[model samples]
Target: MKFLKQFGIILGVSFIGEVLKYFIPLPIPASIYGLVIMLLLLSVKIVSVEQVKDTGSYLIEIMPVMFIPAAVGLITMWSELKSLWFPLCVITVVTTVIVMAAAGRVTQFIIRMEKRQKE
Candidate 1:
């Protein structure tokens, strides 16, 4: 029952994301919109972490299983991917590094802000 409620809330937020994506001119994906909405809601105390924690944790635990289909698709496209492997690898590495750096900087900034607030 609790899982169902949490899952429903998540789905409702995702539905709003889909609606926004349909009406908006931006190129961002619906899933990203949904994530941003979820974050905003949590930040504003409109949604408590405790409400979604169980379901969210469960989904994370099963996330690898969700990648199986994508992995299989990649394997099936091995020949095509091989031809584009160099560019694909370069893009992946570049994006990964950029994201890591951005996340690290954001984390450091947030920690510094929190420490300053405490003092």
Candidate 2:
């Protein structure tokens, strides 16, 4: 029953996001909007973390399964992707390196701030 309630909350929020997407002209995806709403609810204490933590963790645990369909789709589209392979590889590698560098810098900055606060 608790799981059901938590799942209901998540689905309700996601439905609101979908509705917003339909009524609004913005290009953002429904999932992103749902996440933002969830974040806001948690931050404002409108929804406690304990209320959703179990369901969220369960979802996370099954997330890898969610990618299976996309992976299969990619496999089916391999012939079409074959010609663009080199460019795709280059872009992936470049973006990954850039993201890693940015994340590292942000982590370092955060650690420095924490150390300063302790002093």
Q: Who wins the TM-score comparison?
A: 1
The Cα error of candidate 1 at residue 115, in Å, is 1.5
Query: Candidate 2: how many backbone clashes?
Result: 0
List RMSD in Å for every model shown: 1.1, 1.9
The TM-score, computed over Cα atoms with residue i paired to residue i, of candidate 1 is: 0.93
TM-score of each: 0.93, 0.86
> Could you give candidate 1's per-residue lDDT for residues 46-115 as a string of tens digits?
9999999999999999999999999999999998899999999999999999999999999999999999
Write the residue-wise lDDT of candidate 2 on 1-119 in tens digits: 99999999999999999998998899999999999999999999999999999999999999999999999999999999999999999999999999999999999999999999999
Segments in model 2 whose C-alpha atoms lie over 4 Å from true places = 108-119
Top-lDDT structure, candidate number: 1
Worst 10 residues of 1 by lDDT: 77-86
- Candidate 1: which stretches are off by over 4 Å? none
lDDT of 2: 0.97
